[model samples]
Target: MLIKSEQQLLNFIKYSPIIIITLIAILINSLIYIQNEQNFEKDLEIYKKNYIESNKRLTKFQVEKAYKDIQRERENLEHRLENRLKTRVQEVYLTVENLHKKYSHLEEKELLNIIKESIRTIRFNDGRGYFYIAKKNGFSILHPITPEYENNDVSKLKDSFGNYLYKEIIDHFKTEEEYFGELKAVKPNMGNKKFEKVTYIKLYKPLDIIIGTGEYKEDFNNEIKNHIIREHIQNVRYGKNGYIFIFDYDGYQLAHVKKEYIGKQRIDLVDSNGFMITKEIIKQAKKEPGFISYIGSIMPETGKPAYKTTYIRGVDDWGWAIGSGFYNLDMLKYLEAKKKELRAMNNESLKKTLIISLILSAILIALAFYISNILKNFFTRYHERIENEIQENRKKDMVLYQQSKMASMGEMLGNIAHQWRQPLSSVSTIASGTKIQKELGMLDDKEFDKGMETIVKTTKHLSQTIDDFREFFNPNRVKKEVDTQVIYNKAIQLISSRLTSKEIELKSDIDSTVFVTYENELLQGLMNILNNAIDAFENKEIKNRIIKFDIKFQKECKMPNCDIKECSQGKEGYITITIQDNAGGIAKEHIDKIFEAYFTTKYKSQGTGIGLYMTYEIINKHLKGFINVENSEMKHDTQSYKGAKFTIILPINIEEG
Candidate 1:
């Protein structure tokens, strides 16, 4: 009912599946792509963070390893310094031992002078090394670098650090034949500033004399420091452009790739943004050894200051800030490559998703068409079955119509005989009388003319009656204009004889309205109703047996389910015929079924049951009108009459069959 037609239904079935699936596919693919894009952004950010964090860790570890290498190399330098001092002190002690042995018979002063002179000229450690001899009572017997303090009772004398330097040295000699210790002394070549000196002393037991020589690191910066910086720290390299650089807190570049940078004050170094990179590195190094960002900083690739992430470390003992970094450009390169890979992967994923959606949509479309085809075939078969059934019913209706026509013909023939009986008798009687008169020679011309004229008139009346009956049963259907009252009177005329034989009174109420319709078919349908009512009166006892035909030009609706636009518009609507009988009302149960074919209450031979069915078929299917029956009460002169009322509504002017 919603689809209205087979083609519309089929079309809907055909296109709906693909349409629905296409929308769903679009929705699903869009969601997937959106979600993937969101995830891509989120994951890329995380990847950047993780990558930067890993590089920071790498830089930190590299700097820490370089720091450890520097520490190891400095320890080696210290060990070598200690070895040189010990070896030189041993040679000077052997010189003293030899001098004491060779001058054993000489005076102690002279022996001491000989030992001092021998050790004095035997300077090692770059001429900053020297020996001294003291008496057993802490008296300075001879001195080389500080000869002004010699030959004095220096028992209360102290070094720059307020220590009794000579007494402590003699006490050490008294206990052990040799000793090694630190004493506050001054380097003659470096002015009179006290410096921590490392000394080795030996006892000359033959003269009860103490001899000592010492070395300090006053010249370390010009020699050993440079060697360590050049060999160890500067030579340490990691990745490309990864070099260890050391600068003191005082801003001197201690170890560097550029020879000019080494041992140069570079604290005021700046980058593109005028940011003091070395100053910031130094600041971070002092607080805690960690990472720092250097925007507009230097890079190896560009050789210009750009962005970099650096790790800074402090070597507090060396007053140095150590820093190493990889450039931001390098990290960007790695991240950019990763981004390109992710983009390719995301595009491929999206492509696959779209392709999969397309494939699924295609499959759904195919499935939809497959199902539509199946339904189409089923509908076609169903349509064929229904068509076959409708055709069979139509054929059966035709058969019933023919049978009803035959029955009506029999009734019409009987009515013709009834009406013609008296006329035939009168004609026969007139002819017999005329014949007798002529035979007897007593019949006059007037009498003969009268008899002959009466016969002619009677026979003409009979012929006219037959013609009306013949027209009533005529099967040829054609549309024509006719008077409604005349048509109804003709229907009553055909069946009036049957009503008379049953002692039924016919009441006529006809409206002289005009109609355009099939004349004979309408007449036949009306005749069937009158005949059916006549038959219903059989064996019925009714005080005032009456059959009424109330026909009129109905302007209002009669049939409840009327489709005529004129009826709704309150125009000249329809011709309504209400045929009722007071013989008796039809049984309630059989009212609805009475119009069906072969439905009858009478004996099979007496009631063929097709009269009303034909009427229904003509009114509903053929004439495009409607008919219904109901048991109702009709009053005439205050007298109640209850019977079956058959109402028929026909369009006042029908344009279609």
Candidate 2:
């Protein structure tokens, strides 16, 4: 029987090797498949990173290039507008000079006829078809072809063109030089229609006079407006949503893609870009030329990102800005679409590459599986040990999370205790006083009413204390605008009893106008610092223990040295509150760690070492402000006392900090 069993075992081993090898091959194949999946994921991440970076660069380059192109176009338009004005002014000057020479030998009536005939020839030859001449003393003469302006004084006129011409004539008289330029105007006779008019002046030395001629701007070469309109269209065509427009220095629409907008008073348009065209551009137009970009809403639009990039250049002759811009979004969409397409193609290619990798991985896995079966039984016991270790590690993680929660709870509770001590004492004292007065039989009707009122007030205070604690613990409140004075008053009220108990004198220099944008619970944070100051003063034996709280409204101040991220630029105002105490100051080495959680100078039982840490969190993270500490000698009367002062500088407009 023994011989027969041995022969059977040998036969079993020979035939079952194929089956065992097949099972091991399957296990190895699964392991290789998992590894290949991980590799594909890593590759996809790399591809995405490369694709995003490339597209970001491309978009930035395109935006910069477009900005430059618009700048060049604006410069060209401004040059053309200036040259046109100069040429028109010269033509009028020469024509008027000839008329003066011819009429020098004639009498008043024949001279007038010659003057009238000369005006006709000048108006026809010069781009301005209708010409009007006004003397410095307010006499007006019109060309024979257009008799409307004859014998009219233009000095009292206040329209854009009239005002501009008046100023140019005065300047020319003062400088004794020929003055020529374009002025924006709205003529009353023309139904108050606005127009850009070219004005020219030449001195008549014999008459001791200045003769000023003005021609309706539209009657001149139309290229002045056309150039402006073309620039606007180019900028608008490249932009995303809105069209571009140009305005003269006086805030009159010179040219716009929309026909109705041309020659309109831009100041009346709610969303006009005229406000952004600086006075410097106008002032410098005659001396130097340049372009500037500004944030302004497109005409006839409301909402954010409704801004257009306006490029302005100085027109020397007209003293106007040849400005143009398109809506920002309109210019950005094309690049955005290109980026999206590139991202999509990258993702698709990545997916195909992953699929190919998976197929290759499957083949490698199949080969590995066949080789692994030979040793599978040797590794089963080790796999069980690893699984047990992983389970133990998970349990440890759960324990750590629980401990962290308990630590946070303990710290929060300590802060609550510090905050509530004063209110609770006030309630207790008021209750005891009420009872004593009633029991002593010394309370009259009025006195009894007063005592009862005190009790009610104390009860309300206790309720408020509870509410304050509840709010501090609740972390879901949204931030809103808050009055800084109210916050300071509340902190003073909360710490009043504590200050009394410790015999610490409280002083405040709070500003009433200081307002802040923050969550309500931020008041609790300030109270925490006041409470700590009270504790520090009480713990030490310094005489005349005092806590000085000052709230200053600063137009601009640096952020405090706390770990808070500044919420806005330092341009806006800030509420700076300084809480100072007259106790022994903290050591220099410990000041740096004062805001770190679980690090405190107080005894283990006295403090959880989280009050200042939580205060830092509230001031920095929640309030979007900063907190800092300084140790210096404080003077009370003639005596010197050393204590720590905590200064919190919070932005009044958090958005600008």
Candidate lDDT (C-alpha), each: 0.80, 0.61
- What are the per-residue Cα lDDT tens digits for candidate 1 across 289-396? 988776743455676766888899998876779888877777778889988998899999999999988998998899899999999998887988888998999999
Candidate 2 clashes: the total is: 14
lDDT per residue for candidate 2 within 118-237, as digits (tens), equals 655554433434444555555566534335546766566566344434554665576575666776554434654558876666665554445555555565445534553454443454
**TM-scores for every predicted model:** 0.51, 0.36
What are the runs in model 1 whose C-alpha is more than 4 Å off? 1-14, 70-76, 94-116, 133-142, 149-154, 159-163, 202-211, 217-228, 295-297, 371-657
lDDT of 1 at 403: 81
Give the 10-residue window scoring lowest on summed lDDT in candidate 2: 233-242
Stretches > 4 Å off in candidate 2: 1-458, 468-474, 558-568
Best candidate per lDDT, number? Answer: 1
Error of 2 at 551 (Å): 0.8
